[model samples]
Target: MSAEIPAWLALESGLVMQGRAVGAEGEKGGDLVFNTAMSGYHEILTDPSYAGQVVLMTYPQIGNYGVVDEDAESARAWPEAFVMREMSSIHSNHRATSSLPAWLKEQGIVAIDGIDTRELTKHVRERGSLRCVVSTTDGDTTSLVAKAKATPSTDGRDLASVVTTGAPYTWAEGYHESYPHELGRAFDGAGTKGGGERIRVVAYDFGIKRNILRSLVHCGFDVTVVPAGTPADDALAHDPQAIFLSNGPGDPAAVSSGIAAVSDLIGKRPIFGICLGHQILSIVLGAKTSKMPFGHHGANHPVRDLQTGKIEITSQNHSFAVETDSLPDHLELTHLNLNDHTVEGMRHKTEKVMSVQYHPEAAPGPLDAGHLFSRFREFVAG
Candidate 1:
């Protein structure tokens, strides 16, 4: 066994928590946020919405199932570092190819364990998200705090460009793991079939999750994912039956290119957007957006379908939300978050465009929201 190295995390507000470095020995700093989910640490770490932030998992014990390539939301981890109360020393999972610590080291991510995450989380909840530094190399609290305080704000930055694909590509795979085939949908790897023709679909990738592509493919659509900045005419050139706008990081209004392109695509095709895509769509349609206090970042969020009066527990991760009152007369609210009564889903009355502020992909969340994908397919088929 190796000797445990001492470490510490210093918040920009001058609070310090001592711990031991669990992963790579390094230093990193960024906006601090917390996730309340008990599992799927891999997905959370790789999510592009976590870009330029240090994620502190509120769950007590983490890294028990180990790390697997099959569970990755993206190609690499995006968090500046990971914080936790305890990290499992032994990893035991059938599909895991590497231990979490080893994987973090390989990915050049710094992790710290042995801190009281509950207290830290409570502090963040009260004060809202703030700049923070977690380090294994530096122990000077004053210097670390100074560095954290000096870090730039993450809002309004074009972080989508940092994580989006450089060129257009087709996603052919479907959900192979994470749960059983209970959604009444099946994918044969190459494509999926749901009693409909293989409708060509254009997907705008503003840091999309793999399961979203899988969901579209499994719903019987041929998906072509273009960059976040792709123009409306270029996307329409494929003559897609529908268009999908993906979720991503940072302020939605700052993505000027996406707002402009989506604006042009409006009323041209059947459109569906999720998370950041939802915010962009709303902005283009004369709605307003504002940053939330602590932001929604969990899987157990309850959302209500206003049309059916049914409540669906969902998985969500976003810092900004669309103002319900700012919506245009043509836009109709479809879903609302039961926890905060925020806008969760919307659609233009006269056009085939709709969007949701929560992830229906359910990679690390719930399956109740999966019906939205099927509905999207039905819209395209009609």
Candidate 2:
């Protein structure tokens, strides 16, 4: 079932890298970005945060451990395109249900291997993330380069619609299983409840991850996930005890309607946001958002909690960040990215709202920041 697939990745800067296609031989276009994590290719591929981007893994060899059902962050694979130096043809892992190549074919994601990813990453780091096209069927580098150059960047694109579900869906119970790790045992009481009533939580899916909902449900919250464009009034009609904004792709400024909805719900109910959700909250609070040159797209990012003065390694995937200088008086900065000193987390002084720019659920990253979920749970309980 293998075919000799020729492909070329053309960047907006007119730089073209020739390679061979591995998964779902086709053409795909997106903003090209790189990740530095040595592992967790499956989690990264399924992460909705990478919706409109062709993810390039800086760590050379990928797909060694293969794909596992339990490790999937989202319900479906989402990377528009995947780039790596080399993809392991033979997967080796006890929990692996299928190889990465097989999983990509099933999901219809275009992937490229046998390219120097480090050089490409270095190029992106110096020139910033750019729109690019990965073509497997087409070998005309000139036309591909032209198309890549003409493609619009992620600046004002409303890519959330592309990745979000069209209708509200309910996750059946028992979807999440517990695991014991260094962070301690999770889901101690899976089916049994001690005493307190189940907290009803309404999550607005602007490209949500399965892990986030699982984490909330594991914390005793009865979760109901809604679509991205669901109106604030409509969400409140559900009588949810808390509101959650899921991580998503594209610009926060482009999601003006969602920002407005969040503004209306501010101070009305406890709310928590991640990644793009965090940016939207800041925009609702009169702060501004700007696109990063290269952006952060890795699992080993370091973020310092200003309140506790403790640094936690986190998983991050975003191209836009909330401008700390433009934050309103009521909002307080809670976390800072130690690498770039960017605003990572914020809380409203007078409102029951808090958000973080990094993924605390950590599908492919560290669990050091899992306490943020506990903080959100406490906020909802109060």
Candidate 3:
């Protein structure tokens, strides 16, 4: 590997850290947040929900498995920068097409390694997410701190519009499995319908993940992905049997168009949402959202399913959550986060509407909540 260059990071709180640069030799600033997942660094780096933020991995060692195109959650990496304790120099995965640092440079992602990630994670845990700057081209801590503080805040920003797809498209791929037809759902090995019938769904692409589309297809839905700003009439023009709201970045309240569209779409057909989508749905149903001290960004969050009285280990990556007390009478809390007592899942009392704050697709995580897709299928069919 080439010799690592010097890099410096400065939080708006005036905290400074010195490390070695591994990715692009440039400067960048964003909201500094940490993720606790032990793996899936590639997916985390590419997740559009991380837009406008600098990601610091809590896991001590990252990039052990290297980078592969098939593992990317989106077409490109979205984080403003990547930080870690030790980015492995020697990646050993058989599927790796390129080393982590090499790919990050190629993608123009500014990154730093060999730092006290533990201290950084603890700081964020106690003080909430902070604005920060990472620079390999500059070493002045005072200047970096000022730049960090001057970085634009994600609040009241419509980032969903920034990351959403440019046009509508159809998705038909599913989970690549050894035996596709033998899974829970009856399928003809192609993720379509075996009996020549399939539920048609229109999914709002609020910076959606590819795995989610694959999961929907695996559950037997023909998905049509539309842009985030698509109006209610335009989405309904697809004549969908159900509507799906996808996860995204930034303040949910700022996604005004999405909330308006969802408000008009409610009760017309079955609807399901995930992550930011859940927050948007709750807002339309008379609830409110607030940013968490340190948002849930991990694979091992434990949640309780109120309807089943079962605990599920879920994967979550959101900085805002629905306010429990603000929920309207028309909606029922379906799941709760065991750790923080926050709302994780909810459903309409009378309509075919439900949503979860965690990712059920489980990309690079556990399979505990994957059944929610089938539940949505049953919900649409009913």
For residues 168-227, what per-residue lDDT tens digits would candidate 2 score against the true structure?
766545234444353323333422233346777788888888878767766667788888
Estimate the lDDT of model 2.
0.83
Give the per-residue lDDT of model 3 (tens digit) for 1-382.
Answer: 4666999999999999999999998999888888899998998988899999999999999988899888778899999999999999689988889999999999999999988999998888888879999999889878988999999868888899999999999999877653233343522232354443678999999989998988888778899999999999999999999999999999999999999999999999899999999999999999999988878999999999999999989999998899999999899999999999999999999999999999988667877787888888878888
TM-score of every model? 0.96, 0.94, 0.96
Q: Which stretches of candidate 2 lie over 4 Å from their true place?
A: 1-3, 172-195
Which residue segments of model 3 deviate by more than 4 Å? 178-196
For model 2, which pairs clash? none
Clash pairs (backbone) in predicted model 3:
none
**Minimal lDDT window, size 10, model 3:** 179-188
The number of the candidate with the highest lDDT is: 3
Query: How well is each residue in 13-63 modelled by candidate 1, as lDDT tens digits?
Result: 899988999988889988888888888899998888888788999899999
Clashing pairs in 1: none
Residue 105 error, candidate 3, Å: 0.5
What C-alpha lDDT does candidate 3 achieve relative to the native structure?
A: 0.89
For model 2 the local lDDT of residue 98 reads 95
